[model samples]
Structures are given as C-alpha cells and as structure tokens.
Target: MSELINNRQERIEVMKNLIRQLHEGRDEEKVRRQLESVLQEADYSDVFLMEIQLMEEGISRESITKLCDVHTKVLKKHLDLTETPDAVPGHPLHTFLQENQALLQRTAHIRKKIAELEKVSEEESADVLMKIRFLLNELMDVDKHYRRKENLLFPFFEKNNLHGPSTVMWTKHDETRSYLKSVIQALNEAENISQKEMIAFARLAIEPAIESVEEMIYKEEKILFPTAMDLLTEQDWYDIYLQSPEIGFCLYYPEFEWVPEGGLVENVEKIKASDDKIHLPTGSFTLEQLINIFKTLPVDLTFVDAEDTVRYFSPGKDRIFDRSRTILGRKVQYCHPPKSVNIVNQIIKDFKEGKQDVARFWINFGGRFIYISYYAIRNDQGTYLGTLEVTQDLTDLRALEGERRLLQYDEE
Candidate 1:
C-alpha cells in the first residue's frame, strides 16, 4: 500500500513539473513525452484532478493539450466494454465536431486574409478589415461551445462535488469571451490602424484566446472529464450523452460508444409506459387526451423540471414558437441557439434562485404578434418546483374591443 501511494505521488509530482516546465518555455515535446509516460502507467482518472491543478497554474502548453486528447481516446477505449457501436454522424459529439471543423476552417481562412492584408498597401486594407470583422462575428460560435460546457457539463460535475475544474474552466472561458469582445471593439474603433498595430492586436487578443482554448482542452481531458468519468455512473454518462446533441460540442468529436446501464434503461422504459396516462391532483387523462386539450387551448405551454431540464413541451399545431421533442430533457440553455444562451441562463438562474418570478417577451411573427411569459412554479412552502412557459398568439387578443356577451361558433 505504501509503495503504491508513493508511486502515485511520484507520478503527480512529475505531472506538475512538466506543466511548470511548459509554462517556463521549456521544450514542449520533451515535457509532453514525460507527461505521457506518467499518464500511461497511472490510473488516469485518479491523477487527472492533479493535472487540472497544474493547468490552472498558467501552463498554456499546446503539446500538453494534444496529448490530453490522446489520453482520453486511450482511456475511453480501455474502459468501454459495451457492445454498442460508436455514436453516429448526427450524434452530439459528431455534430459538435462537424460544427467545430467548419469554425476552424473559417478561422484559418480569416488568418490567411489578415496575413494578405498585411502585404497589401495601406490605401487598400479596408476590404480585408471588413472581412476580418465578419470572420470574428462567425467566431462567436465559440461562446455557444462554452455554454454547452458551462450549462450542461458543469452542472453534472457540480452534482459530483468536483467543482474545482469546472470553476477554473468557467473563469478561463470568461477570459476568452472578454478577449474576443476586446478584439472586436478595437477593430471597430480603429479608423486606420497600422500593420504593426493590427499584428499587435492579433497577438495580444486572438493568439491568447486560442491558447486559452488549447489549455482548456488540456484541463478537460486531464482533469475535469476524467474525474467525471470516475465519479459519474454509466447511467449518468448516458444521460449526458443522450442530451448532448441539443447543445453540441466544442472542437473534437468523441468517437466512443455509450450504453446506458441496464437499470437506467429499465427505469426509462417504465417512465415511457407510465407516460401514457397522467395523474393530476384532481383527475387523470391519457397522454393523447392531454395533448389534444393543450393544442385546442388558446395558449401554448412548456414545462421545465425542477432540475431545469426541459421536460415537456405542448405542441400546439399553430405554436407561437417552434419546439421539438428532441429538446425535451435537454437543459434549457441548449434549446436556444448560441447567441441567446446567456440570456436564457440568466433567466434560469434567477428563476432557480427565487430572485424573479416572471419574465415576458413580445414579438411580431408573420403579420401576427405574440406574447411569451415564463413563470416560476413553486410549492406551498415557496420551494421552487419548476417553470411554466406560456406563449399566446396575441394578434386577435390585442384587437379585442369589448367582452362578447354571446358565444359564436366557427366551422371546425
């Protein structure tokens, strides 16, 4: 036992030293090799937490991040014993990687354009600058990638008491966000920036943001993810895997197969069976009956669970907003596209913390105006139960002149 503990400690020390060396500008390949050897021999999940700490200490090594991905591939292969096949093309990880591939290709094209701009005469750089800004706007997808992690992945980690890596990664994510904003602001404010100024801005803003992302990959693979794998049961991972498609991935695709635990599968089957009928406080109704009732009603409805998972969405045939069953059980953050995730998250947080009760929005759609409102649902003790989202097509409602004394029937 003593010898085993000593070996673990020695491996941890070596990992820390490699990170320190990388941070100090030592040969990256050499440090990476040393770290790789330690990782191969170590119980990866156990030591990954320590590695995350090293990354948090300012070691932004590209080689280390690359190796970390390699490590994940290896560990996943070793631990994956199920008969299920790998995720298909449209799987969350696959979709995420596909999106990332496009983003990376775009970034590369932008970099080349920026380089070409430097070569051109100062009198003709405006076009290139405009293209650069457009590229930056496209690059805003990184914010979406980060949101998937923060809202979906981080909550799982928090449930497991592994807050260290998630917190550090969130801080780094915010730094990247701020850097992107600063670069965009600088570009917008410059009426005529010299080549030297442009280069400086690229180095100061873009390079560091990219480096931070690389380092985040390191921390996730070496620490955050491994710890999650250790602490989370197979069912827990399966739940994440099932819901991941809605939010998407950051850069790389995880090509592993995930099979839910037998117990989880059984439980889910039970839920599905029971879903045929709903027992309310006053009465019971078949699922189909409930659906018909909600669709015929004047208002649309959506239900988010106490855990903030989007559990139910009433599909009114003429829904004021679009929704899909795919988004059911998804974190509310993932349901919205990247640009709106922050606002969604803020609303959810406020709702959960009991700081706010109602949020409303109005919009015009297809010549008809609509109103949407989210209400925090609570129990008798004021304990939050979930949220009720109501949306109504208000075009007719807004035009109402007076209360109708007699009912009129329209052809069905």
Candidate 2:
C-alpha cells in the first residue's frame, strides 16, 4: 500500500492478496481501505493481474461474477475514461461504449417517467403503463449487446486462456436477462394497473433490471475493456468486428467501414476448406450438397446439441420463426421468451429422463395453424443426443379434406 513497494510485480502481488482476502470473508471495510490505498500507487495492470490470480486460486467464475461489479464500483475512480485508451469507430469496443451511453440516456428517461407515475391516480395509470411498456421495449435491446459479447468477444478471451471473466460476465448477462424478462411480464400482465401497483412494479421490477444493466456497463468499461485491450491484438479485435453484425447492432451503428487485414482471404479459405465429401452409412454427399438439402426441407429445422447450444438451423426461404446466425452456438434457453424457459427446461428434462421422446404444440397465429414439434434426437444405442425443433405452417394442409395423388399446377 506504500509508495516504496511500487515495483510492478510487488503491486500485482499486493492486489492479488487483497482480492483473495475480500473473497475469503475478510472485513469489507478493511479490504476496501487496502484497495484504495493500493490504487494510489497501482498501475491498472496490477488490478488486471489481480483478476487473473483470483481465478487461479480455484474460485468459481460464477462466484467471481457476483463480486466483479462490487469491486469495480470501488475502482471506478482509478479507471477513468479519460485515462483509459480510446477505441476507434467501427471497433467492437467503441460500439459497445457508445451503446452503453445510449442505454444510460434511455434508462434516465424511464426513471423520470417512474417519478411522474408516483403522483398519478389509479384511474389514470393505464395510459402511463402503455408509455412505460414502450420504454421497456427499448431497454430490451440490451440482449443484443450482451449476446454479441457472449458469442463474439467471450470466445476470444477463452482462446487466450482468460476464461474466468468471460464466464463470470456471461453469468451476469443471464441475470440481467432474467430481470428484464420480469419487468416485461409485470407490464404485460396488467391491463389497467393502479398507481400503487405501478409504483410497486417500478420498485420490484423496473429499477432492479435497469440497475443491473448499468452495473454491467460500469464493469465492462472499468475492468473488462481495459484488460481486454491489453490482452487482444488488432487481428483479434478485427475477428470480433467482422462477426459483430451477425448478432446485430445495439442502440448505435458504426458508420465507418473497417476491415481486417487478410479478412477476405481467411473467409475464403474457410469456405474452400470443407470441400471434401462427408461419408455416411447410407451414402456420401459434398458439404455443399448437405447444406442445400437442409435448406430445401419443407419444415424449418433447428438442432440444439446435448449441451443446449444451437449447432444448426436450416435456411428455408420462408421460415416459420426467424432464425439468424446470432443464434448459432447460443444457449437454447436464451432463444425463447423467459416465461417459456421453464417449459423448455421441463421438456429437456423429460427427454433426458427418458420420460418422453417428443413434445408438440400447435397455435393459430395470423390465421395460420403453426405446428411446432420437438423430438429427442438419439442414436441407435438410445443415448440422449439433443433436441430437434421442427416448425411448419399447416394452414393449407388442414383445409384439405381430400388428398390429390396427381400434381396439377394449372391454377398457377
């Protein structure tokens, strides 16, 4: 904590010990005091090393995630935006920072609305609820921000063996997603909410959800981004930038065109790399043929692997439900509305337990009878593989009382 111990390695060790103490039930005030004292002489790298050391001590990333923002709140003064390096336009980091600023403005506006709602009468609250719902929808875009981090940025961190923070941050993302879902549900369930109910909803749902998002923004800027800047090279960042649009942008767009060096060559090589045939027991097909066959299927198909990560989805011309590359490798639970996640979990559990091999649901949507069925994809030995979700619009099929054996296209 003294200037005499200002050697980089010594400072990193002190910071590491301080973090371990904080985690091991040391007095919070004492640890914070020590951290503050160290920050006076500590370079930012010392703090980054602290995070790496904490994970090295065998602590779970989930546990670290809960503590990440707490410690960062204290370090905010030390890691000023003015002092941290700048990210260029179109860079993934720059886009994220801009989105956070946009989110802050939007959240501030919602808070003002919530303040006004405190005085409204029960009879007049319905109009206010509708307005609040729109604001909540805007805030819901946070998912795209978090998803890009999980799918694009996190993988690079893992590649460098900096797995703890990525895992920890993803857990926090799930928490924020859960909170957002509850806030949406609170708004949707009540048609004519009373002033008291509206205030209660704000207290119970809105504030916490927005606060979770804000805290995550702080963590990313104060700790995650700085460390990542030091860890990732230009090529690593370019790799993420190329994949950014797949998950979609957040509240802002990158106007400048930025391309990675050799990016086109790398992509072309990937395309040509899989030209060999894939042989199966029945027969063999080239990769291109297999891709076309999946796309040509009448029903939209999605395969969620045993790990619950989406491994594949067919690109039908008219998909019953929207599917995007963003969904590739994403957790199946996050793909659905949070309300239905429990039902999805139950179905997966039943499949794993061998209680059921299939689950089907049909709903009339937009005058179309949309049939959705989930089948447990398994091997001949009966081992659980994953879930295959097949969806089709059956409006025309149901109306047909008789089958026509011959194809006649004169009507066209």
Candidate 3:
C-alpha cells in the first residue's frame, strides 16, 4: 500500500498490483480510487511495464487484452499527455498522429450517421444506412494503419524486449477487424430490414467496431506512442521512416520530409558496403539488381527457413498478400490466423518429412481469384532448406479466353 513514487521499480509494482486487482474481479472504482490516491500521475512506460510484469507473473496475454480497455480507462484520467515527447512533422510518429486524426474524423462522421439513423423514418433509414455503410468502407482503411504499427513499429519494441504490449494490441487489432467484417456483412444483408431491426444491429455490431477503433487510438496516443518515443533511438525511428512507404499510409499522407541532422550515416554506409555483385551457380547480379528483380516479379514470394522463421519476402508493387520486414524473424505460424495455424504447421511438418514437395490452394478474395502455392526447397543431397510460398492474383489469368501469339504490351 505504501510505495515510493520516484522509484521506477516501485511504481511498476504499484501499477501492476492495481491492474491485478482489476483483473481479479475487484471493484474497479475502489481500485481506481486507490490508484488516484497512491499514484499522482501514470507514466506511459509504467503502464506497459506493468503489463509485461503481469505476464511474467503468469497472467495470460488474452486476459491482459480483455482487460486492456478497463485498466486504460482507469489510468486515462491520470495520464499527462502534455509531457509526452514531441515528434517532428515528418517523423513516423507524426505521420501516425496525422492518420489517427483523419480516422477520428471518419469515425465522427459514422457516429453522426448512426445518430441520424436512430431518428429517421423507415423510408429514410435505408439512405442513412447506405451512407453509414459507405463510411464503414472508408473506415476499413484503418487496416493499413494497424498494419503499419504491427509490422513497422512493433519490431522496435520487441527488439527492446518489450513484447507484451504489442502482443496484446495485435490481438485487439484482430478483434476489431473481425467486428468490422461482421458488421459490413450484416449491412449488406439488411436490404428488407426495418428501421428498428437495423438500429438494433447497429448497436450490437457497428457501435462496437467504432468503439474498438477509438479505444486503440487512445491506447496508441496515450500509452504506446509516448512509450515508444522514449524507448526507440533516433536511428531506429529513421529506419522505420525509410521502410514506411513500402507498407503505405492510412487515410493520410505526410507532406513534410524529415531527415536526421547527421543524415543517414550507418544505413548509407551499409548500402555502399553491400553493393558488390552476388554470384550464384547459374547467374549473378548486383544486390540492387536482385532487389529490383524481386520487386518486378509477378508473384508475391515468401521464404520460411527450415527453422520455420520467415527469412524473406518480395515486396512487389501489387502484392497478393501484405507482408512487412517485421515478419523476417517471426515464425510462419504466427503469420496466419489461429484456425489456419494448424494447417500451416501440418504443411511444414509434411514438407520436412519429405512426404510433400508442393501444396496449393486457391480462394476467391473480394472478387479476385487468388492462387497460393507452397514448395519445399532442397539441396542436391536432398537436405531440406526451407519453404517457399508464392501467391498471385489469378483473376485476369483465369478469365483469359486465348493466348496471344503476338508480342504486346499492356496499356496502363
């Protein structure tokens, strides 16, 4: 009950105890009151460290995610955002902030539409629902926002040995994605539905989706960004800034350019040092040529080494599946959803045992026919090396009537 606030360790312990009380079914208001009385202000890092410590103490990540919002609400009042570090106009955090602002505007518009739908007559309800649906479609751009954070930002935190917060947030992102998908499906099926029924569905499904998105915004601004700003070095942020364009932005584009005062020192040096040509048994190419070749390839290629870790992925302009450099050292199984992880593991298992050389599947995704294939790579001695996953959009190819014998270039 008595702890020194100035001591970082003591603060972490106090915060962790308060969070455990919330998780153990204790009265939230009472615990919050205790928190307010004991801790004058909630430091962003303390909140994350508390979660990490709680996990170390045997609490599951799922439990932490479920209670994430509750504890965040409790700590929200005491957070001093004004003290959070400032990010310059072109910094990655600055861009993220800009994107969040744009997303907030979209969410505000959707909320207004929902409010209008509640008061509109049955005849007018359909129009209101249509507008809301359109807004939801626009709101789906948040996926890119989440992906940027997941793939670009989370890696730095993991490198610092701070994995708990990112893990919990990723689970929340998936939950939000699922809710958005379900609500969109419900809206598509509400053709003949009555105003009352539509409003009920909105409350049951749509509102939660918006709420989840807003909750993440709060978590990022108040907890995640401030913590990251403190933890990540100047060089680390510069690296993220360089790779950000590859994954793209969400709802906003940064107009300002930011280069570190000393410029890209180590990165440029590394590039110069690695500019030599690489020779293979059959052919050879410079590192730059090889990189561009991969980018120009028609298929999206991913290589998972024999250890099941993602070693490389091609970043073609029109990729069939989204991938980021964060996936480089991540396990392949973590790349898929929980339900499909078993299938992924089985494929890897069969490939390792020499039972299969190739596996293929095709699915219709958002009206596009997608073909995915996995092949086992081996050496001359038949030693297993890795799995190569190739994905392609086959919609146009599937619809081709006849092959053209004449050379032709497709118009842009």
Candidate 4:
C-alpha cells in the first residue's frame, strides 16, 4: 500500500475494506496496522462516508451496530488524533461534551465505590450498596441525554439523508439503556443475596453499563460531532439549542447562554399568513381568532403530533400547569418527569395501537383537584393523527351541590 493515499474514493474503499475485515473476525490489531496509513490521514467525514457506503451496499444496520464497538477499538488511535469541533458555551455540542464530563465523573465515582465494596466488611457492605444504587439512579438521567440526541439532533441528519449512522447509534443507546435497567434491577433485588453473590452481580451487570456510556462519549467526540459539524448548517444547530430545554440536561446544565452571531429569525411568511382566514368544512377563523378561542376555553390544552412531538399549547389564563414556547418542538416524553415518562409512553403506545382512545386521571396538586384527560386525535378515516391533552382545575366543580336550569353569571 502507498504511504500517500489521497484519492477520496480510494480512501473510502480502504476504510470500508477495513471495516469489513473487522466484521469477518479478522484480528483487530492486524487489520488496524494494515489500514494505519489510510486511517492516519482519514478525517471524520471519511469515516462517515465509509459507514454510509457500507449501508448502501446492503449491510444490515444490526450488523453495523454489532460491529460498532469493534470498529471503534480499531480506529481509536486515529480518532483520538481527529480534531473535535469547537463549540461555545450553551451550544448543543458543548452541552453534550459537558454532560459527558459529568457522566465520566459519576462513572469514576461508581467504580471507586465498587472497589470499596470489595474492601469493606460485611457490616459495611450495605452502605456501599446504598451508594451504588443512588449513583445508578442518577445514571438513569442519561435517558434525557440520549433523548436529546435522538429527538433533537438526529432529525437534522435524517433531513440530510444521513440516517443510517443515527439508527446505528440509536441502537447502541437502547443497548446501554438495557444494561442500565438490568443493573439497577439486580441492585434493587440484592437484599437477600450473599455478599459474594452481590459482588458477582455488580461485576456482571454494573461495569458494562458504565462502559457503554463512556464508549458513546468517545464516538460522539471522535466521529459524530465532528462529522455533524462539517455537515450541518448554523441554522440546524440554532434550532437544536432552542429546543433542548424541553428534554432538559443530564448531570450538567449550561450556565453560559450562547447566542450565535446571526440572531434568531421568525418566519415572516408565517406571520403574514396568520392574517388570512383558515377555511374549515363548517366555518372559518383567522389565526388570531382561533388562538383566542383556545385561550378562552376553561381547560388547558396541548397537542402532540403522532410522532410525539409537542406541536401546540393553548395560553389559557389559569393553566393547571405551566406551558412554554420552548416545548413546541420537544418530544412529549420529555415534557413529563422521569417517573411519569413510562406512563406517558404507555398512553401513546396504546393510542397509536388503537387499544385505547382516551386516558383520564385526576390528582390533588397545590390544593387544587385537577382533572387531566388525553384523547387520541384521529382523522376522518380513523388514522391516528396525534394526542390532545385537556386539563382542568376541577376543585370548584367537585363542590357543586345543585345545578340551576338558567345560566347564572358568577361574581366578578
């Protein structure tokens, strides 16, 4: 092989061949050495192109995902030499790196605790186990981190027809999530197990979970971030930055506000179109009138699209819960706390599957009895369109003693 491998197509083929060798169980170190000259000069885009081309050639995404770690192992040296894209404070990439730093610190702490478990006596093992559970609980926050990537960042890749790698990365995210869940469950059920058994479980379940997270950080900084920086426009990043708050941050949050040199722009055409009347089968209303009608309704209303993105929320004067514009493009799962996300997912799942159409619940919050109902929005042809959430403060309604036939106005 020549020392100077300059042709773009040749570089791609060499990279692809190396990855194929990895898939075929070639010795990683040997293959790496063979590809050293080519990889030494390969940048992040070249690596991305290699994966995309492999996918185009009918390589299964599952196969690529399975080989992803092996690919990383072979490419780690050159990837380390690859320059990371610089991002200012509050930029999405900067925030992701910061979260990775926090996650690394947490994983280090967990490893130290695991080591301490070995040293501590049986009398002290309980305390060590407790600390590990607490850390694992915090580690679960990584779901928000991954959700931000899948929901906020990956869409831009899809728009660019660069969907394969994102799918592969998402598969890895699910794998990490499974490991975290299994470890957490094993820890939760460790009460009756022997100390030796507990230690074995820790080794079996915990270590892999932490390593999955760390490996993802490596992939992001080395390949994904740099390639995305090369491919995505400034506007794409700006949109991601704005919508990130809906999902929130992981262990870290950005304190510094990042404003791009180019300011945020509103869609002027949309604003102009708002003045025109919207025609419906039965009636017509200007956008202003439509908005006012929603605001005047007694219940707070939010509409999430079929894809689970929050698309609209009514600005009622007395909403049972707060609503913000930041949530407009956010995923519905992130709108709820971690504990309730499972229920939210279940509701959407049932709605989409047509197992159910409406879910209702009532809770006493802040001394107010609030009634919440979720209706699956569907089209005339019975196709699921999205979900409509209607929330009302039912404290006064629950106290009603009698009803009057005639309408009566309450005191001002």
The TM-score leader among the candidates is 4
lDDT of 1 by residue, 294-369 (tens): 8788888999878767777776787878876544544565455444656777887898899999999998888989
| RMSD in Å for model 2 | 6.9
Better of 1 and 3 by lDDT: 3
lDDT of 1 at 347: 82
In angstroms, how far off is 218's CA in candidate 1? 5.3
Q: Of models 1 and 4, which has the larger lDDT?
A: 4
lDDT of each: 0.65, 0.78, 0.83, 0.84
In model 3, the runs with Cα more than 4 Å from the true position are 1-6, 80-84, 265-412
TM-score of predicted structure 2: 0.62
Clashing pairs in 2: none
Q: How many residue pairs clash in each candidate?
A: 0, 0, 0, 0
Q: Write the per-residue lDDT of candidate 3 for residues 1-412, one digit (tens) a residue.
A: 2354457787678878888889899999999888876567546777888899899899999999989989888877776443545688989999899888888898899889889988888999988887888777666667778888999899999999999999999999999888887787667655589888888887888888999998898888878998888888888888888888766667676787677666676675675678778999999998889999999999999999998877789989888778765455555655664346669989999999999999999999988999999999999999999999999999988888967999999997
lDDT over C-alpha atoms for residue 14 of model 4: 82
lDDT of 3 at 53: 88
Q: Give the local distance difference test score of model 2.
A: 0.78
Using lDDT as the measure, which candidate wins?
4
Can you write out model 2's per-residue Cα lDDT over 1-412, one digit (the tens) per residue? 5555557667777777777776787887778788788788776656656676778887667667767776776566676642545787877888889889988987898888888787777666666766777666667777889988898888877888777777778899999989987887666666656688788888788999889988888778777788788888878887888777666666676786565555455663664676668889999998889999998998999999887767788999889898766456556765675447679899999998899999999998887999999999889999999999999999988888966789888462
Collision pairs in model 4: none
Ranking by lDDT: 4, 3, 2, 1
Which tens-of-lDDT digit does each residue in 220-325 have in candidate 4?
9999999888888888887788788777777786887666666544543454576779899999999889989999999999999998977788998778899866
